[model samples]
Target chain A: MKALALGILAALILLTAPGSQALAAEASEAPGAKPLAVGTAFPDVPLIGPVSPELADSLGIPQNGPTPIAKVKAEALIVEIFSMYCPFCQRDTPTVNELAALIDKRGLAGRVKIIGIGAGNSDTEVDIFRKKFKVPFALFSDATFAVHSAVGQVGTPYYYVLKKTPQGFTIVAAHLGLIHSPADFLADVVAKAGL
Target chain B: MRRIVPLLTLAALLWIAPAMAADPIPGGLAGNIYPVPTLPPTDSQLAVAVGSPMPDFDLPTITGGRVKLSDYLGKKNLVITFVPAAWTPVCSGQWPGYNIARDIFEDNDAALIGITLDNIPTLYAWTRQMGDLWFPVASDFWPHGGLAQKLGILRSDGVSERALFLVDKKGVIRFIDVHDINARPDLGPLLEAMAKVHAEK
Candidate 1:
C-alpha cells in the first residue's frame, strides 16, 4: 500500500511538474479545424430551442418549430457559443448581459439580434444559466454538439457575427475568449457586421 | 551497474507517459470519454446510512486551506458531497451546476463541501475550470481516500462514490444519498432535504 501511495505521488508530481505544462500549451495552440471565414455564406443550420414568442416575433419566425439562421429578419446576428460549465463563460456572464443591453442601449436591437448556443449543455443546464444570470436573450441546448460542429466551434465562449446580404448571410467575424469590454466589443461587432 | 541503466530508462519512459498524454484541460466539456457507472442501489456495504454522525475530518482543500467537518457544527448545516472523480462527464457537470446554486444552500442555512480522492493540484485544475465554486473542495488524497473510506463510500478504484450527506447543525447526519455514479443527482431532492433539516430544528 505504501508503495502504491508513493507511485501515485510520483505520478502526480510528474504530471503537474512545471516542465509538463508544454503539453497543455501545445494543445491549446493547436490550430482548430478551419473556421468559416469572412465573406463565406452562412450554412442553413436549424437552431433547436423553445424560441420564445418575443424572439420569434423579432426574428420574423412563426411561434412554432425550430428557427433557421436563414429566416432571421435582422440585419446582423451574433451567435455566442458557450457552455454553462465553462469558467470563462461564467465569468463573462455579466459582460454578455451587458452586451445584450448594449444592443438595446444603442438602438441596434432591431437590426442586430443575439442568441447563444449552449454547446454540450442540456436544456436544463442552459435554463439554469439563464435564470442565474437573468439573461434576457434566448439560449438553446446543443446536447449533441450539432450546432457546435456546424459552426466549426473550437471552444466555449466563442462567437460568430453574421451579416445579412441580398444573396445570403455572410460571415462577418469570429471571436474567441471573453469580450474585454462591452462597449469595445459592441463597437467591433458593429464595425465588422457593417451595421 | 550496467543492468541499472535500462531499468532507469524504463522508469523515465513510464514517468513521461502520463505527462505527455495529459488532457489539455483537466475537467471541462471536451475530449472526455469515460463511461458512466450504472446507478447503484441505495443500501450498500460501502455506505454510511442516515441518522449517523458524520466523522470529523480535516482535509486539505484545492484552494489552499484545510476544512474540518466539526467547524460548522453549531454555526450552519453542512452538506458533504463526494464525486467519483474530477474529469468524468457526469461529475464535471455536477459541481458547475452547484456553483450557481449557492443561494439555495444559503437560504437553507447550509454550507457545502465537496470531497474527492484527487490530489490538490488535480482538484485545483479541475475546479478551476468549474468557475467560482464557493464551497471548499477537499482532497482526501494523503491517506488515499481516508475520509471516504471511513464513510464507506470509497470505491474499490480508490475514488469516492457520488454520495451526499446532509448534517444538521447538531452534527448528526440527517439525509444520505449514494446516488448513481453516472447520473447527476437532482437538485430538488437536495433542496428538499435541506428544507426538512431546517424545519425539524
Candidate 2:
C-alpha cells in the first residue's frame, strides 16, 4: 500500500510540475489557427448585425445601411465580437470603454475604428443596449451570429486588430481576454499600428 | 550511526479518520480564476450592494421595466443567477434548481432574476417551457454577453459561466459563488450560505 501511494504521488507531482499538460495543450493549437498574436494577418471578417435577419427578403429587416461591414473603416480596425447578455462581455465593457477613450485621446480614434459586433441578440435589444452602455464605438447587430461564425470569434470582446496592407487588411494583433489594463493596451496597439 | 525514525511524520498525514468524517462538500479554492476588487455591501461577486448603486448598464427586466442595477435598491434583495446558456445539461439542472429555491427567497423578501446570453425571446420561451414560476429571466442578448463578461465570468465560448449571487436589501452583494464552467452549483451550500446571510443582524 505504501509503495502504491508513493508511486501515485510521484506521478502526480511530475505530471503537474513544469513541462507537462500545459505544454501539450499549447502544442496542439491548429497550425493555421491565429493565436490572437501580434502581426498575424487578420482576414476581412464579414459581419451582419441586423437582428434576426432572414433568408427571405420579406423579413423587412433593413435593406440598406452598408450591410454592417462598412463600419470597419480607417487603416486600422479593432473588431470585437460581443453579446449584450453575456456577463463576461459586460464585465469587459469598462476595459473596452477605456480602450475607446484612449483612442480618442491619442487622436487615433479616426485612424483606428472600434466596431462592436453584437451577436445572439435582437435588433431592438442591440440598439437599446448600444445607447445604454454609451458605447462610443460603432455597434452593429449580428442576428444569427453570422459575423461570429464568419470571423470564428469564440466569444465576446474576441478582439482582432487589422491594419490595411497591400493585398488587403492584415491582422496586427488579437487578444483573448481583458488582460492588459485597457488604457495601456490600446495605447500600445495604436503605437504599433503607427496610427 | 543508526537512528530510528519517529512515527509522527507518517501519522501526521495518515489521519484518515478526519478525511472519512469530512463532508463531501467542496471547500474554497486555490487561485481564483476570476478576481474582482473587494467591495463592501455585497457578500458575493455575483451580487452587487443593494442601494450601493448598481453598475452602469441599461439591462431590461423580464417584467415591464427597463432597469439599471440601482433600480432594485431598497425594495428587496436580488438573487442574480448567471449561467452559461440555456439547454445545456448543468444549466438545465441549475435553472430548475433556482425555481425550486423560489420559496426560500420569497420567505426572505427577495426577488429572483436569471440572466443569460440568450435573446429575450429565447429566455421567455425557455422559461415558459421549463415551467419556471414567478422568477424573471432577463436577456443580456444584444450585447451578446455584456453582463457575464463584465462580471469576469464569461467563458471563452462567449457564454456566461455558471455563477450565483445574493444581493441584500442594501444592494450589497451578500453571497457569491462561481464554479467550474462544467460543474453544477451546490444548492445545499447555496441555501446554507443564504441562511447564514439572513441570520445576520
Candidate 3:
C-alpha cells in the first residue's frame, strides 16, 4: 500500500509539473514526433520569404527563392514557429515584438537574428497576420506546411534558440508557448547561446 | 495512512494552483481543444449558386444580439461561412484565424459572418476559448440549421457543411466554396473574391 501510494504521488507530480500539459499535448498532437532537443542538429528547412532588402541582408539570404535556415549569418538564431489561426500566437504578438526589440536594445542584434514561420498559412494569410500584429522580424510563409513538417509539427508560439557552429547550427534551447517576459527570455537566449 | 493523506493533498493543491491562476488568454493553445477524426471531403451538395440571392437570416448571435443578413445589403459586402459545429478541430481553428484578418475584411469593405448549427450557449462557450473574435458569430439552432438547409448545406448527419459564400453589396452570391470537410479552405481564393467584389461598381 505504501508503494502504491508513492507511485500515485509521483504520477500526480509528473502530470501537474510545469509545462507538463504542453509536453503531453505536443506528444498527442504529433504522435511519433519528438521535440528537437538541445545539442541536436537543427533542421535545415527552406523558408519562403524575407521580402525586404534589409531583412535579407540581416539573414544573409536572397530576397527570392527558398533559403535554408542553416545559411542565416548570425551567431545565434531564434526561430518562432507559429500559426495565424492560433489565438495564443495572436495574443503573444506584442511580447514577441518586444523580444526582437529587446535583442536590439541589448546590442545583440548583430549576433542574434529572430525570424518566424507561419505554419500552414498562405502568403496572403501571413501578410495579414504581419500587418495586424506589426511584427518586427522577417516572417516566412509555410503555405504547404513544409517547414512545419520538417520541424516536428509543434504547436504555435514554439521557440527554438540555435547556436551557430562550424558545421551548421545546434539547438541550444526550446520553449513552448508564450514568452512571459521578453527581457527575461532574451536574457536566457543570450546566456544559452553564450552571446 | 494519515501521513499519506497530507502528501496527497499537497499534490492535489499543486495540480490545481496553475489552472486556477488567472490566464490572460483563456482557452489558448494550452486550453481545452479537442482533436477530431478526418472526415469526408465534401458531405453535402450546395443548394445556393453564384449570382443567386443568398437567403436572408436573422439569427441569434453569441453576443446576445440578432444579426440580419440583409443588414449589410447596400453598405458592405459579406462573407458568410458555415462550419459543421463548434469545438471541433477545423471549426475551432478557423475563426480565430479570422481574428487576425480584421484588416483584410475592413480593407475590402466586407463583413464576415460565422455560423454553425450549435446553439448560442454552446457557441458562446466555445468561442470564449478562441479569445475575442472581431466578427459576429451567429447560431442556426432553433430551426435546427434552418439557414444551412435554406442554403442547401445541411448534411444528412444533421450538421452543416464546411462552406463559404461570398455575397456582394447587392446580396448576390459572388463565389461559393463547399470545401472538403476535413481540411481548412485556403484564404487566397476568398481574399481574391473579396477584392473582386470590392472592385465592382
Q: Model 3: runs farther than 4 Å from truth?
A: A1-33, B1-30
Residue range B125-167, candidate 1, lDDT tens digits? 8777665779999999989988888899877667788898899
Error of 3 at A50 (Å): 4.6
DockQ of each: 0.14, 0.01, 0.25
Locate the minimum summed-lDDT window of 10 residues in model 1 chain B: B26-35
lDDT scores of the candidates, listed in order: 0.76, 0.57, 0.83
Residue lDDT tens for model 2, A35-154: 445666554545444432331132222543434343344678777776554434555777788887887777775577777776544454455456556676656666565566666545
Ranking by TM-score: 3, 1, 2
Best by lDDT: 3
**All candidates: TM-score:** 0.64, 0.42, 0.85
Candidate 2's displacement at residue B64, Å, is: 25
Q: Which ranges in model 2 have alpha carbons more than 4 Å from their true place?
A: A1-41, A47-71, B1-201
Per-residue lDDT of A38 in model 1 = 71
Question: Which consecutive 10 residues in model 2 chain A have the weakest lDDT in total?
Answer: A23-32
Q: What lDDT is reached at residue B85 by model 3?
A: 84
- Of candidates 2 and 1, the better by TM-score: 1
